[model samples]
Target: MPKPAPGLPTREQILDFIATSSTPAGKREIAKAFGLTAQQKIILKAMLKDMADEGLIDSAPGRAFHKMGGVPKVTVLRIVDADDGGNVWAVPENWHAETPAPRLRVRERKRGALGVGDRILARTEEAGNGWIAHPMKALARGEELILGVLRQEGSKLWLQGVEKKERREFQVSDAGEGKPGDLVLAEKAGRPPRITARVTEVLGDPFAPRSFSLIAIHKLGIPTVFSPETIEGAEKIAKTPLGEGFGENGREDLRHVPIVAIDPADARDHDDAVWATSDDDPKNDGGWKAIVAIADVSFYVRPGSDLDREARRRGNSVYFPDRVVPMLPEILSADVCSLKQGADRAALVCHMQIGKSGELKSWRFTRAVVRIAANIAYEDAQAAIDGQIDHPLTDTALKPLWACWRALYKAREKRSPLDLDLPERRVVLDEKGRIMSVAPRERLDAHKLIEDYMIAANVAAAKALEAKKAPVMYRVHEEPSREKLVALKDYLKTFGVEFALGQVVRPATFNHILDKVGEVDFRQQVMEQVLRTQTQAYYAPANHGHFGLALGSYAHFTSPIRRYADLIVHRALVSAYKLGPGGLTEGEAAGMERIGEGISALERRAMEAERDTIDRYVAAFLAERVGQVVETRITGVTNFGFFATVEGIGGDGLMPVRDIGGEYFRFDEAARKLVGEHSGTEYASGQRLPLRLAEANPVSGALRFEMVDGKGAAPERDVKPARVIKRRGRPANIRHQGRKR
Candidate 1:
């Protein structure tokens, strides 16, 4: 039904216009609706043409014709002071994060905006210009725009989080106001279909640890549904045991075994203990059986309890430098559920027989009612092995312990060469959170005793789960990237050693290289490099095998008090033994499956936080020794300078190219070298250099070092310089490796 407009009403008399009507209107009639002058009509046509190029509008053939419906069809009369104004968003419609949920990326347009290896700088979405996931585009299964800053490095996002509640109010337009924390669904008023949303949850103060954690949690969308109340509630429901906590009912008593705890000296929340004794002679093919009794935490922390809910939420405990943010309360983690010394706590035991060759013969998993006979520290255990400490570890206990460790020692040679000696540093902190020192953490035989038994238990559990067809989470590590190996190979060549740069680099080959340098003073630095070239692995139901351990199956079945993974493993094992370890419908185990994802994310968070804390301490320690000359190994090389870390120091410091006295240096990413543009003087990864600590800052906890005596220096590169081509790389020549004699 057409309202008699043109036939009855003159163009000048028309009050308002209706879009897409049954009756067609000419340009003049539509222009009349806007009360547009002849000159203004020409301007509108020009504006339409410009908008069309951006996919915002469908343009007519010539300036003489008027078209509609190509753009979003927003109508506004030119009553306000309108000029050549556009929308506020800077990102193009096609920009996207090329990685997973936590990865955020952006195109940089200015210097110092970001560079490779720099921390991602977090920013807000100015009014309607924020970057978040575009759900519609996601529904369309294409691209998404995230709020992130791009860096000059690998395909990874430096996740910097912004909290909504902390946002201040903004005047998006002179006529409009929006609060900082308010969630806004913004669309482009200027260009093609542009829309973004802002959430109202303020992340917290930027410098706060909570802020860092917030960026990670919200960015990854790790479920934090369980609250403090839930934690309190879990405590209430955990009074009764979940599995073997059913007491001496359906399990064997192994409390009399010479079970001993071997953990970090300061560790309070113990998890698993070890014992290797002669197996039931009638059943064993040969040799002894290793018994691993992990704390029966699943027995006490029942499913659906408040504690369980909160534990499920945190997924795991985060360890900081000075303290640990536990998954459970101190009452639970440090006492009741903890595998405390000499305490008669219930446990879930895995019994496996070891053959003459140290290979597993047969294994059985059960909820055993037992207690830890010894709560000894690793140092004490180490002393006992060395026959040094005469007090804590008695001669009577030493014999059995020594025998077990000796047996495991032989097993290493018998088994595949899986023991990869990685350098680990212990960060020291002062009273004011400043770095005191960085000391190498000692790895001992006692530590291995515990490790060997745990590894055996992991194998047993994996096999049991597979045998029963149980749906359980396995900690699987994946293979390294081929591209990373090429980069590493190029970097290694600066030091002058021949290595495989083709195909993929094997862990065993890398391990062999590290072993060859074991007598070298710079071995730790090389080991540190190896750590960077590796990838972190995590939990999945399907078996991918652990790359580092060279194991076909692996799982974390210890430290339930601290790690949620351990608890999940315990729960699975308990259910399996009772009902048989097997796959169940995902529908029936939705809660637990969700728990797996959340905990896996938290585990990463905890690891990152721990590393961050150590970095802080290392920085603090370096600050104290500023202006002091220290010998350092070039653990890494970049366009900026060589990254050198001294032995006995845990923190990393930078040596700017300017500090090198002789030649102009440039970063060659392809070659992983710092080459002199003029002199051709070079330095590569793993080279020993004498660096004088120049400057250190406490707030950022970063240290800077300068070369003391090396010649062949080139003029310093500009603050922000262009990239350069790299030469072929080789293994480094050891200038300071200890002689075999």
Candidate 2:
């Protein structure tokens, strides 16, 4: 057919031409291709000028043109990995790693002071083969990198810092490319004034198999693989037994005592052992003598040594479902320092006397040489105690140990600590390192026995040091703040339970609430709330008395092979008691404050890593079963959505308000619920509901759920609607509408 009337091209048509063109097309080329007349060409020129002004197209001198708005004016980026010629590459702050992020060539001057884990906001522009960026603001600059997921909201990107205690999200540069669910390594550029980040590298998707542990390990900057020097030092220490040079001298020989080690079945390190017997003294009638000997790690890993430094840096061993990242190398943690059965090992022993009432009468600390009479798991020990299983040492050793545990438990009961019986979920992995199942780890009497003994031993160590005026790092759990107590009282009022809030609330105060909740339907929910209100336990140079344990003074003095704090306590005991050569040095004593803070940070880091790994594995396990209806109890309710833990699997998922029917909901913080506007339906914490798994994104470690039961509000007389009145016309749950903005 003949050509129709020549007319000016629409914006869409012009854009399509430019996009489909083999190369960046100019005005003359566009006019000729579209068969525009001379008058139409004039109009086309004006349109091209307008498009250029609108950032729709880039017009260069001499008619060169290209697509515009490809590069952001400002974005956050990090120099992830160093390339050849000292050049480094960067990804966008909100990268999901769905694909490769845009490569950036930062100027040499801009790259100065920038290192891995350093985050920076920069101005970016397209250069010859890649984008060039000038870092305008340095957000955070540190040696440690943060591993987290990148999330995009409109044109802005945020890093959901996976650090356990960090609740605030940090802004990231948008220049580099990342999806919502990508695991990324980020860095802080300068300092506190600028709180932003740049994605240095994308680790992987959070939901991928085995990726969960990796993300946690990387995010927390946990040293999974030991350094060559640490490994070599550990290997050297392992080759020479501690008894050869470091043992026997000034050491009490406790090998004659029938001290047996109790631990988990899978535990490789036997750090502490217990021995108990009736005191035959008529003056001390109805009394028992108990001895707790912990592995002497300081005997091998001395001060300022490679192993010691690494252990100090790690703070404590991180236990993951797939594997363990030991504070010390395997040679020390699993062999030399491990108190194995019938093997002579050096130890820090506490000889304690307990009267008939389980009250500690007297205690003293000393260095010792001991041989573990037996090594038993918690399950086997419990079985023997229950008369279901028989062991060679059942009558002679196990029975006395059980009796000692019973007496100590009586003391524990008398103390009336905040006994919130929250069962911790344990992830069981198969041979291939995939999650087989998730279940609550049974808390047996044997477990409690070990715990009680450890507590007693720790207390003795603190007492010994305090008596000597030695500098000690106390495991302090401060009392709940006034604000937290007020919130707790308000929450308890919703359940028709009232707490006397004015007086000094002690662990005993929480125990009353916990005991009252045991028979309630929402026991777990109430326990969780109580736990949330309690302060986190951490090491401090000054004693602040542990509130949760109801202890006037406490310090971690068990499992020196796993915990650096315990190692320090061992050194302090040696120093205070003048036991031997491996004692706390003056330099270490002076720097105890810094060390305490550092180890406390590491402990929080490990907790975050462990929790994140579990979340990832749970997400992976449920990925294949999308759309299956599952039962869950709402654990948390916000304005946007409610979070629930899946009943059997124990995986937490978000049920967005938008998916909870058409009713607009309002968040009632006091009630911990979302109240529907028109429908009057409420989704509150502790409410059991059926949900269908709509999506499981392993990369993001996020699960989305849809409401299965279309149940409305509770019965009229039975329920008390929150005071928040619903409004008409607009939606009430606007905050929960969408995160992408």
Candidate 3:
């Protein structure tokens, strides 16, 4: 064999040097460290290239070298999983190795617990067998990837956002295999002034049926596919015997109680059943006894298990117009855990005693075996009560439920919860996923009856946990902040409505303000303002009164099949009552705060995804009606434009100031209006107007409108250049400010 070059390092030596380097080691650094001669340097470069080809070392930015299977000493990582012992695991942020990315145990240092999808900057070291990462700092979360259609504008490709409020078109840098008008998922490649994106996946046609929900599923990072382990766990748990000993083993038998579930007509799963009857005790005349049985999801999804982890990661089931992204596998969420009629199901039942005045006198929790007598749709239940349909279970089950709900309604009236009668739009889709129609869902008394019972049961669970001094995840909705209240007051003054800021605020206060508005349009406008004034409700370990429900304590204990918060509550109840196994564990109890925060964030994400999908669906439904005049109500106003929603169908469309025609409009911030200088015409929220739909983009869920009578013409006189305005505080164009009258 020929003699080796004097400074050439062996393969093992090169790998060790790259792995242990304090700083990024490129070819020059490696050559310097080995003291290579000038001629040896050329040989070293060839050796490094051969090593890279052999998959021994990889090159990063700045031509830095790293061990192919190892992470850089200092690098960015994305958290992927958490173990049973509460340890988090992460992988390289930009992994491109042929092998699966190595999981590195993250050792947090005086920082909050990290969750899946969180990004961090870490310093890594090779431990005895595995890699360990010490987090240097947490990175701001990257924006979710965009799911949109690729469009070609004069040979320049642009990616259109699939959200109603996303107005900017991202410049496409690399289109990959995506063609113009194809649905594609793209990631941000460059930052602003000239924002750009690179298409990652070409998802066929953008106008295909069912594409609307797919856009949301990918854009929001919602998990639609379950892991194999979780599915196997669910299947195994689903086969567990529910009636071996006939409720003799740590379970009460309530199969003969004639419980009934009332839900929507197209409900996919029934998670709650209600049973009520008159209180037979003479001392509690006119009172009622009730049981609210919720699906025993905690029993099937135990802590530290695969099912539990996946459920926690989902936070809650996301319901779209066409389908549902369930938190649990179908075996559990749809079949085993659902309260199906005539099938014996294990449940966590809440037994409550009510007084004549509908006050909850006493409550207890127990594990039980239940058999739902019927699963009736809300419309059918209301119909039976009105004598429109003759049903066998109605007189026996539905009547008693209504009787019980009447008493609860009395209590609800006294508490006077915030009753904003906002109409929720429902998107009905055909089997092919094409839009059939969009309309406001009917509000019925039967719906209110079921809601009240659930609320009562949720309150009982919270108070029961408090009595046992156990952990509780309260559904907290705090009073509005002073800033929001002040804004609401300023807006209300525009309507000549007096709102006293000094008075202590309650749900009833808003309800009273809404009651005084006789006009429906004005009432809706005020309702919107009231909603903007309220704080978002969320789950927390600490107690904060539920302002919307007018309850001193509240917790979700129903629908465990859909919501993780309710599952946690179920575990708490089981541990508090000593009902059986599947109780809250010590580790879970200790991390309640972190769990609350993570799930709350997931809930917000789900809401946004659902809303975006609905907007897309609405836009698609109205695409055929372009150039037609429609009745609209102004919903919001800004300096640049005013937003309005269709009268019968709800889809927001913007009327830009430039399209309003022949005038320069001044934005009135406090009053939330726009006044045209030349025409002396005024536009404000709650004003009914006729607008011609000019353009509708289904890919972006955006709609553009113009005044039905006004021509699209420039203002008669030249005016000062327009500038961006902040959403808060006083308006820059207020009278007598920087103006000559």
> By TM-score, how accurate is candidate 2?
0.73
Query: Compared with the true structure, what per-residue lDDT tens digits does model 1 show for residues 65-87?
Result: 21222211221111111123321
lDDT of 3 by residue, 1-741 (tens): 123336588888778778768888888888877777888888888788668755677766446888777777788998766656667788888654457889999997743377666789998888987899999999987654778788899989998877666768889999999999899988765322444888989988878888888888888789999999999999997887764333446588899899999999999999999999999898766699999999988888889999999999999999999999999999998899999999999999999997777889899998888999999999999999999999899878999999988999999999999998899999998998889999999999999999999999999999999999999999999888666788888999999889998999999999888877766667798998899888788888989789999999999999899999999999999888877778999998999978987788789889988887888888888899988898999999987779998898888888877668765677887788988777768899999989998777776677788778758433355444356554556553422112123
lDDT of each: 0.55, 0.77, 0.85
- Summarize candidate 2's per-residue lDDT along 630-660 as a digit string, tens digits: 8888888876678998876676787766667
Q: Residue 188 lDDT in model 2?
A: 58
Q: Which ranking of candidates, highest TM-score first?
A: 3, 2, 1
- Give TM-scores for every candidate, taking all chains together and pairing residue i with residue i: 0.66, 0.73, 0.79
Question: Given candidate 3, what's the lDDT at residue 533?
Answer: 86
- Residue 496 lDDT in candidate 1: 51
Better of 1 and 3 by lDDT: 3
The clash numbers for all candidates, in the given order, read 36, 21, 0
